[model samples]
Target chain A: MKAWSIEKPGSREVLKQIDVDKPEPQTGELLIKVKAAGINRTDTLTRQNAALKKPYPILGVEVSGVVDSNQSTDSKLNAGTRVCGLVNHGGYGEYVVMRADRAMILPDELSFKEGAAIPEVFLTAYQTIYWLGELKNEEKILIHAAGSGVGTAAIQLAKQLSQATIFATAGKPEKQEMARKLGASVTINYKEESFDERINDVTKGTGVDVILDFVGASYWPMNLASCAADARWVLIGMLGGSEVERVSLSELMRKRIALKGTLLTPRSDEYKASLSREFMQIAMPLFKEKKLQPIIHTVLPFEKLPEAHRIMENDENIGKIIIKMNQ
Target chain B: MKAWSIEKPGSREVLKQIDVDKPEPQTGELLIKVKAAGINRTDTLTRQNAALKKPYPILGVEVSGVVDSNQSTDSKLNAGTRVCGLVNHGGYGEYVVMRADRAMILPDELSFKEGAAIPEVFLTAYQTIYWLGELKNEEKILIHAAGSGVGTAAIQLAKQLSQATIFATAGKPEKQEMARKLGASVTINYKEESFDERINDVTKGTGVDVILDFVGASYWPMNLASCAADARWVLIGMLGGSEVERVSLSELMRKRIALKGTLLTPRSDEYKASLSREFMQIAMPLFKEKKLQPIIHTVLPFEKLPEAHRIMENDENIGKIIIKMNQ
Candidate 1:
């Protein structure tokens, strides 16, 4: 089996295509033949940080593949069934094994590349927006990193499922435009304007009901200022920095804000399986009906994983970047 | 009517007994002949802080009294009915007005002082534990300021309702003992030992599932370190300080903690009414059955309101301090 392994930690130069033994399906698990895998910032961070203790050297968390074998006889999944799901590790390899309950059958309407893009971003967005944020139909939401994969997915879900007013912030004008096209009621180029001031101005000082933040520390004060009373601020990533300089406890209490920090990868298999069931029930139909579409920036061949990492590092992609196996 | 008013802010010396007009019952409201009232830290803070805009000049927030009049015909409350309820303000008076919906019929098993102590502390504890924390049965919880009003209430409720292991922290040895008596599995004198170290030792590094915190900024880092994965840290007050020195977003994300800041006073009448209903349904029965008891530290004459404030300022009390209205 061919896999992208981290030869040395730190930078895209460390990523190398290497041959590895294929994984076998365990009890209640399925062995998958990788068709396509999505590239995420977490993968890049895992590859770059020497201190991060990873279970495997391979770098992928989500993959779309064909079921090669199933260990559990009663499992709905059988050999040759196309599926996409979250993997604990080793998704960068041509062959990987995943828990059967966590995998969802890929709809015929969706391609392998699209399926690869759906699991991580869509599920994360779904979990954060619906489960953590508890987004209501009439509520207003501010999504940071609007051009990123999770950001785009959140926008589409918010638009399709709820009557929420979407506010988005992106680093570049083109990215802001892309966010606007994707369903953001208002898009701000964060480089050009202060999002807090923009939110205050646009909402007439009412502020947003929920905020999906990836940019931490630098945006903490602004995020607090931009939130309405009883607002939920769901933290998914800390792209800007981690150390919050001075958080006013009084302001948080006065505003009655709920700050929830979430990470999907660290959760148990049972939890992910529940999330998979929910996503399949609610989101799969949207994909099949073309109401929701996976936004792909570029699809590179599996061997060109380093190029995909470079694209992500350069922040040149509008949405998800995919790595296609045998392309 | 006679009421205690703050002539000036910043000290208990500013509190003075003054003559005021008795408030008439408004629509869906009750005019009560005040029997007893409970003193809370919020009352003291409102008295001391010149900047905190209060609804009225009165000192107390919760009172036990006889219903003198009921304005709403549909209300279950009637003249001469004994009730304990939350007052917006003016509870430290000969007479007080409260919303009929917010008032609960007092069980004959409890005294006026106990009834006065129950409303604020028990309601706050219930809202924090069950609603905000979403505490599950058999989960471990850490309660700060375990000798205080809400802390004692929480310990009793958690023990009675949910099979939770309660870990408490207080400044004094006697206070720690009181916490243990109330239902805390372990009590740490925070002055002598580091609570985070104690928690780590006791739980064997698993940490607490929920932390009900009143001491804010100073305990921020320690609180984060003391929490288990997916912990809910419900912040009810900021007695220690408001400015958090340095909060690591990464740690919050990695632990997947939910940091919620709550204030019960500023919420709408409808919201508080709903909470009152829930407390009546679930907790009132426990009080009736003598399974849960309100812990009262002392009963001071209503005229000695300043003395009550002084005791609170010195942090000398083990449990709730009540003011007897007509003694």
Candidate 2:
């Protein structure tokens, strides 16, 4: 099996393709012949030794492929079934093991690359928006990195399943338009203008009900400013920095807003499986309904791993970067 | 008219007892003859030039008194009505003007000092538990600084409304006992042991469902560790600071927990009034039924302003501290 292994965490230079023995499916696990995988910001971070514990790290949390083998005959999924599921760190390979319950049957119309891009970001946006964000109809939503994968998924979901008004933020005009096409009510160029001022102006000083943020320190003050009374601030990634600065408790209390930080892995297996199962359930239907579509910025062959990482690190890509495993 | 005024934002030296023109009720407002005022942590923070943009720093936020004058025929209340409500500032005085809708009619059986304490902490805990925390019976709740006025209020309210398994943390044995009497299922002396470890041990590795935290930065790590799967972390204060040295994003996401920093003041007038009106409806009967009582530490003459601030800053007192305008 061909896999990208972190020989030692340092920079993108450390990620090297190496030959490895194929893994076998454990009980209740499905062996999937990896076809495509998505590259995320965290994948870049993991390669740079910025993980909970360094070394022995494989990139990619999202995967799509045909099930090569099934551990149990009683399992609902059988060999040759097209599927997608979240992985611990082993998705960036020719073959990977996925839990049977976490596995979702990929639609016939969807390609492996599209299935690959759906798991990590779609599940994250789904859980954060409905579970943590608790977004409902008529509520105002402020998505910070609206052109990114999670932001794109959230916009489409809020557009199709919920009636909430979506306000998205991006640095460039094209990316902002991408959010608008995905059903964003308004787009704010956070680079050119003050999001807090603009948000207040747009919402008539009522502020937004929920905020989905990726830029950490840079967005904290404005995140507070833009959030509505009893608003929920959901933070998944902090591209700018992690350390939050001093905030005025008076301003916070007045709005009764809550800042909730989140991530999608490092959760127990059961927790991960639940999200994976639901991604297969709720999000799969939406994918089939064409209400949501996975946007791919570039499809790089597994050999061009270094170039993909460089593109992501520079924030040059608007949507997900997919890497197809072809030998 | 007599009142306590802070000529500037600074230490207790700025808190001066001075004669000023009594506040007159304008259209759609009420003039309240303040019998008792509750001093909260916000009051102490305001006096020390700590509140957001503190130039005209008047101290109090919660008060109970008779309606001295009512200029709003739009409201149901008359001039002789007893009421309690929350305000941004300007509460520590002989007469204060409030929007007619903000006032909650006080029960005849409750003393003015207790009523004053009820408005701030009770409303704070009510929102934290019901609206933000969404605490239900049989679920686990951890109230940090469980002996403080808000903590005590949360303890009693959780017992009365939800059958939540309440765990409370206080620095002293006396305070822990007080928390237990207020209906805490278990009381932990945070000074003696690690709260995170205790929380796990008490729940057998499943942490509390909801946490009400005031000691922010110092406890952020433990707060994460103390949360159960899908836990709600609510930050109400940061006496210990606001920054955590290391934040595990993966851990936050895996558990599907929501971390939120919240403040109970500065909400829109309409929002605050709605909360007040809801709380007055739900909790008014509890006070009259003797199910809930304001835990007052001491009532001092308004001239002893410095002592009140000192006691609150030192964190030595139990429950709330009250100051009488006339004694």
User: Measured against the native two-chain assembly using Cα atoms, what DockQ does each of the candidate structures obtain, in the order listed?
Assistant: 0.84, 0.22
lDDT of 2: 0.83
Give candidate 2 misplaced runs (Cα > 4 Å).
Answer: A50-58, A72-75, B1-126, B134-145, B156-173, B180-210, B214-231, B236-327
lDDT of 1: 0.90
For candidate 2, the per-residue lDDT at A15 reads 86
Over the stretch B1-327, how does candidate 1's per-residue lDDT look in tens digits?
899987778787878888989988889899999999999888987887778564448778899989999996745688989999899988999999999999998988989988999999999999999899999999999999998989999999998899799999998888888888888999998889999999999999999999999999999988998999999999988889999888899999999999999999988999899999899999999998988999988999877888898888888888889999774
Extract clashing residue pairs from model 1: none
- A-chain TM-score in candidate 1? 0.96
Of candidate 2 chain B, the 10-residue stretch with the lowest lDDT total is B49-58
Worst 10 residues of 2 chain A by lDDT: A245-254
- What lDDT is reached at residue A88 by model 1? 85
Query: In candidate 1, residue A56 scores what lDDT?
Result: 39
RMSD of 2: 6.6
**TM-score (all chains, Cα) for each model:** 0.95, 0.70
